[model samples]
Target: MKKLMLGNEAIARGAYEAGVRVATAYPGTPSTEITEFAAQYDEIYAEWSPNEKVALEVAIGASFAGARAMVAMKHVGLNVAADPLFTVSYTGVNAGLVIVVADDPGMHSSQNEQDSRYYARAAQVPMLEPSDSQEALDFVKLAFDLSEEYDTPVLIRLTTRVAHSQSIVALGQRADVPLKEYRKLPEKNVMMPAMARKRHGEVERRMKALAQAANDLWINRIEMGDTSIGIIASGIAYQYAKEALPNASFLKLGMVNPLPRKLVESFARKVEKLYVIEELEPVLEEQIKSWGIAAIGKEIFPVQGELSANMIAERIAGKALDVRPAQDLPPRPPVMCPGCPHRGIYYVMQKLRLHATGDIGCYTLGALPPLKAIDTCVCMGASVGMAHGMEKARGRDFSSKLVAVIGDSTFIHSGITGLIDVVYNQGASTVVILDNSTTGMTGHQDHPGTGRTIKGDLVPPLNLINLIKAIGIRHVRVVDPFELEEVEKVLKEETQREEPSVVIAQRPCALLSKESKIPVSISEDACRLCGVCLRLGCPAIEKKPGGMYINQTLCNGCGLCVKVCKFGALRRAGE
Candidate 1:
């Protein structure tokens, strides 16, 4: 059956048809949907791990037990799983193991545009790049086959466009391969120094064979077109280049690492001018140049952001073609939901005129507009460490004014280590954990604190307050974020304390809660037109020529504006 499928969904379908037994991942943009789609199949045991490291480890364990396994994560998530990634390279695998790392170029939903192809090269593993949804499916199946064939883990890299885009994919029936019998093969599985030394040689020899085989790999193909210019491209860049220069002869590579050197040289010899069309770093261009081949890449094009057909044509064709974004469309900026729980907390912080160190998640939106509560956001779990450093750098007066805010899932993911650092080093800072029940930023996927597994199985949720206390926090308190007075009081009390403290902003994500706050409106009679309520920046609150008004249709009546009102202008519905 042929159907339109997202690249992520197609990968899941491909894995199912290929008889993959286990799949795991921590939710991250451009990669989260892969595991979500995988859970729909009964043949696969799918899970949402606490972090990427654990996710990769789970897949590694499953593969070691002779089941074809897969793990998916965004590019930076691979950094967390790098330890296992390197060791597993030396140890090899019993069954197939494919790790999917989706790179977010253009900083769409990422902190940086660190190319993941480097990870494949660093780990000495074969890597594949898929240009569209169909290749995403086909490449995953091929990745598994290559993993088993080469006795190595395979990396299937995707970018934002390819991961989120949709295309027609021809589905296939399941090929159920029974588990390989497990034997006590210490020489192959163990990573002791002596064993690892021998395995290192095996990895080198395997790469040599794969590089030769890559020459004839079906995914890498040559299309005869204009002989004057030849383009070597892969992943989304190939799609752009094909559209940019339809008549340009092409060498499309799917297996990017352990590059087919002979094929590359052969392609270079065919055309008068050779161009390497790729995004970000010049991995291919540099490699080709090292071989004494004349290839033009980033020098002609850009080394940053998503490559567009217009961009490729403008650079290579030597003229700017008619290309412009839709000018008629209105600009829509990102904003927190009307009843977002993080909204109230940020509003409170703004009222107190305090500094905030922010972590990843929806709460990062607090850094924008009327609230503007956050100061710094580096990466997941960096806020706590940043807050402590601020205190030490500026001394007590400046540091006491700062607080670090992190989500429950993010706190568990990487913030605990920072908290440990605060306690051991005697740093006095207030850390507030927004316990909103689930991973909100990445489509509300279940996390360790949600009391449910990825597959909807009931499990005991991790207690955030108890865990904070266990970390030797003497002053720990849980405050309802909706209660403005309580939130302010707790924030004031915690920031003043001489020791490391924690304030748990206990509230479910407004979207996830069964109850909704009564939507309120502006009372015309009680209006002083002070514009204090405007500071909350709720989308429902608006200022028209007539006067200040609330869009009842959009309001959730969280009453944060009402709490901040000095003249009692804002009132509840039906009041």
Candidate 2:
């Protein structure tokens, strides 16, 4: 059967057909949907692990149990799972194991545009790059076969465009491969120094074999056209290159790492001019050049952002296509929703002039004006450690003016270890956990504290307060973020303490709340236009020539603005 599917959905379909028994991942964009789609199949046991490290570990355990297993995550998430990844390369796997990492070349929904192909090289694993949904499906099944055959894990790299784009995929039947028997082979499975030394040599031999086999691999093919210009590309870049230079000879590589050197050399010899087209980093260009092959890449093309057909045409073909430039529009920076619970906490923080070390999540929006509350945002769980570091650097008194802000899901991901460090080291820092009841930034996915699984199965929720107390934080306070006065009160008290403290601002995300919204209104007669309410930065409030008016259409009637206004200017609709 044939059907239209997203590259992510196609990957899930491929896993189901490949007889994958287990799947795991942390919720991250460009990769989240892969596991979510896999969860629908009754044959696969899918889960949302706390973080990429735990997710990879779960998949590893499943693989060791002699079952086909897969794990998916975004490019940056690979960094989190790298610790396990490097060692797992030496141990190999009992059953087939595949890791799908989606790269965001344009930083569309990510903090960085990291190319994941380099990971495959560093881990000495075979990497597959799929161009479209069809290739995505095919490559996954192929990756599993390669993993077991070589006794090593496999990587399938997907870019933002290919991952989100749709294409028709030819479906296949499930393979129904029986689980292999697990044996206590300490020499092969255990990674003691002596055993690791032996496995390291095996990893090197496997790479050599895979490189030789890649020459005959069906996915890596050369399309002969006009021999004037030949472009070597993979993943989405291949799609762009094909559109830009349709008549040019092309060498499309489905297996990117341990590159088919003979195939690349043969193609290079055939064409007069060769260009390596890829996005983000010069990973392909650097390695290919290291082999003393003359190729053009990153010199004429950009190293930053995504590549487009227009760029390829202009640079390689020297033809100006009649593509209209997008008309400049007014900049609409992302802001907190009208009724966002996070807004109240940021307002209180700004009022108190507290320095907030922020972590990843929607609350990072607090760094934007009119709140301007967050001081630094490095990565997930960095806030807790950074806040503690600042206190130790300056003095105990300095901690009184500093705070660390993180979301509930993020806290569970990596912040808990940082919090434990604070207590163990005898440091005084204020940590604020914004319990928004969902992973807000990634389409409201469930987490450990959500009391639900990826399939929305009811489970016992992890108690945040109890966890904090157990972490040695004695002064723990829970406040409704919607209640601005209460939030402010808690912040003032928590920041004044001389020991580690936690304040969990508990509220359901505005989008998740099914409560009726009675949009608030501005009392025109009592309006002073002092711009106090405007400081909240809610999208519902609009500034005009005459005065400030509440855009009722955008307001969710949370009355946060009403509390911020000194005068009786803002109130619920109809008084």
Candidate 3:
């Protein structure tokens, strides 16, 4: 049967049909939906692990137990999982293991445009790139096959465009693949120095064989056309190239890591001008050039963001194509939603004029304008460590004026380690836990503290207050972040404390919490056009010509702005 499916959903379906028994991943953009979709299939045991490293470990354990396992994460998440990735190459796998790393170009929800194909090259693992949903499905099934055939973990690289885009896919029944019985082959699975040295030679041999096999692989195909211009492309770049250079010949490569050199040389001989048109990085261009072949890439094409048909066409045609002119719409940057629990905490932080070392999650929005509560955001758990480091370097005065804020999910991901460093180092750094009850940034996936597992099974919730107290934190307090007075009082008190302190700004995210029916409004007669309410940075509150207005639909009736107004100007519309 054929069905229209998102590339992520198709990959999940392919995994299911390939008889994948175990699947795990941490929630991250462009890659989060894959696990969410996979969870819907009854045949696969899917989960949201605490972080990428744990997720890969879970999948590795499953593979050791002779189950076909798959792990998924975004490009940066791989940085956390890299420790096991390189080692696993030498350890190999009992069952076929496929790891999906979705790369985000254009910084779409990412901090950086890291090319994950480099990781494939670094780990000595084969990598696959699929252009659309059909190939996403096909390649996942092929990845599993290749993984076992090569006795190595396979990496499937998905970018934002291919991961999110929809295409028609042919569905298949589950393959009757049985679980391979586990055998404790120390020489193969264990990575002692002697075994690792042997496996290293094996990995090198495997790569050479894979490269030779890649020349004949059906995934790498040559389309004959006008030989004057030949383009070598992969993933969404190939799609863009096909749309732009319709008349030009294409060497569309689906297997990108161990590039097909024989096929490349054959195609280059057929065409007059050779061009490598992959996106984000010149991975192919660099490799092709190393092979003593001349190609045009990165020099004329951008090494960032996405590639569009018009951009490719314009460059190929040597003139701007008749395309839709760009629109000058006012930029609509993403902001925290109305009645977001994090807002009140950030507002209090800004009011106190403190430097907030920040961590990843929705609270990162605090770094945005108007609030601007956050100062430095390096990674998942750098906040607490950074706060303590600053105290050690700059002395008590600076530490007293500094704060660190992190979300509940992020705190569990890696922030706890940072917190331990602060408490152990004799630093008087005040760390604020933005306990919003869910992983707000990554579409509210369940975490350890959320009282529910990814499979919707109930679990004991981690008590943040008790956890802090047990950590030897003398000043541990929990306050509703929506309560402005409490939030301000706690921030002021904690930052001034002599000992290391923890303030848990506890509130459910407005989107996850049961919402109030009543919406807020401005009393024009009482408003006085003071614009103090605007300071809250809530999208529900906006300015009009005659007076201030609140979008009743957008307002959650949290009355955050109402609490901010000293003039009794803002209130619930009914009140």
lDDT of each prediction vs. the true structure? 0.91, 0.92, 0.90
Error of 3 at 384 (Å): 1.7
Error of 3 at 546 (Å): 1.0
Candidate 1 Cα lDDT to native: 0.91
Candidate 3 segments exceeding 4 Å error: 322-329
- Higher-lDDT candidate among 1 and 2? 2
Evaluated at residue 337, the lDDT of candidate 3 is: 95
Error of 1 at 214 (Å): 0.6
- Model 1, span 1-575: residue lDDT tens: 89999999999988998899999999999899999999999899999988999999999999999999999999999999999999999988989999999999998888899999999999999999999999999999999999999999999999999999999999999887799778888998888999999999999999999999999999999997989989999999999999989999999999899899999999999999999999999998999999999989988887888899988888888758565677788566688888788877888899899999999999998888888999988888999999999998998888778899999999999998899899989999899999888899889999888889878999998888788889888888888887888899999989988999998888888788777578887788898888988888788999898889899888887777888889888888766
- lDDT score of residue 151 within candidate 3: 90
For model 2, how does the per-residue alpha-carbon lDDT over 333-399 read when each residue is reduced to its tens digit? 7877778999989988888899989998889888998899899888889999999999999997788
Which structure among the candidates has the greatest lDDT?
2
Candidate achieving higher lDDT, 2 or 3:
2
Model 3: lDDT of residue 110: 83
Instruction: State which candidate, 1 or 2, has the greater TM-score.
Output: 2
lDDT, candidate 3, equals: 0.90
lDDT of 3 by residue, 1-575 (tens): 98999999998998998899899999988899999989988889999888999999999999988999999999999999999999998888888999999999998898889999999999999999999999999999999999999999999999999999999999999997799998889898888899999999999999999999999999999999999999999999999999888999999999998999999999999999999998888899999999999899998899988889888888887757566767997778899999898898888888889998998888888798889989988888889999999999999999899998888888888888888887887889899999888988879898889999888989998887788777788898889888888888888888899999998888898997786658886778888888888878888888999889999889888888988898998888667
Worst 10 residues of 2 by lDDT: 317-326
Query: What TM-score number comes out for model 1?
Result: 0.97
TM-score against truth, every candidate = 0.97, 0.98, 0.98
**Model 1, 561: alpha-carbon shift in Å?**
1.5
